[model samples]
Target: MSFAEPSRIEPDDNQSRGIALAILLLPLTLPLFLFLCLFVFLPVGLFAFLFSFTGELLFYLSMWNDGRTLTRRRLRRRLAAGETGTLIIEYPMLAQGRTHAWWTPDDISTLAPLPIPDRSSDEYQDAVLDLMEQDQSHPWDAWCWQEYTSTSQGKASLLRVWNGKKYQEWLARHYPSIPIVETTSEIVRQLEIEAQQKSHQPQP
Candidate 1:
């Protein structure tokens, strides 16, 4: 299945913060180094300069690599081959903090799609009420259209489509066979429980 036009996923807030900090520190390194060289110790000054420069260089490289271009390319090829698997795009928070794995076709019978709850559903309404009652913020409270699950070797893997408008459109068009059925966090919790149970079961 073809993916929606690859929209560039930006680095997360933590990464952006790190990049900004690095940029701010980079200029100070030279002045600090110069002061150290003139006053206290040449080695200390050199260390300070090298440390700041290297840190910034590494941060920039990391930001560049986190773009996910390579992963998307690989995922497209795999999808075309009818491989139902999870593509972990690190830059996005779509998966809601779960271990990521891509299962081979031999690993599971099929990928089951879990539909997001509609506004009218009692479950959705209850969740909203709970949110107001608790008055607490949750990142995962955002609406998600569906979740895909696959099981292999007694373990379950959860997958969510990357949150890109174009990408969701592409999935709808290309993978209509994938049914969208209502699901909730309870389903994911159940899968985790089942996997744990399986793991604890003694092997023959």
Candidate 2:
């Protein structure tokens, strides 16, 4: 299926979120300032305010740079009919480095939708609660779909669809032949099996 126009993929502004966070935390310095004014000398109070402001600014700037690095996007060419090349899919995470997988046109088996799990599912609810407890932020809104591919070498993840609902819908419409699965775990299991097989292979 042909890809939508390049303009359709809205580029994320990486700095905006960091700036908002910094602004939200800026008020926290006021308490430190007050504390200093009540017990410390005037010169010491002024120094503390400057030090706190500078530290806060630096912390946010560091976060902004890291966010920019993780969310950076590059222009990708649309796949044409009979085209054969490597298609790379990236998974960006906040606590860990980004990971990627690749597949060629021949290796792809099907494209599947990855729906958000129902809130009633205990596993899903627990995962959400765990994230909340950790107080960590995430870059992804939702995992929209996945591309499953296989070869004699074994199965591999061809692509991970994120923030691409429209693109996924267009693909589903144009490529009616590809079977769409509902969950990601099945494909993940296939990948794990592949990894096990590869690990067991004798040294060349």
Candidate 1 accuracy as TM-score: 0.28
User: For each candidate, what TM-score against the reference?
Assistant: 0.28, 0.22
Candidate 1 lDDT, tens digit per residue, 1-204? 997998999879999999999899989998988887787897777888787566545633543354412244555677788776332221112223322222223321243223434534666656655664664312222212122221222222223222323333454587654332322233333445566899999999
Residue 86 displacement in candidate 2 (angstroms): 11
Q: What is the C-alpha lDDT of each candidate?
A: 0.43, 0.40
Off by over 4 Å in 2: 1-79, 83-122, 135-163, 177-204
RMSD of 1: 20.7
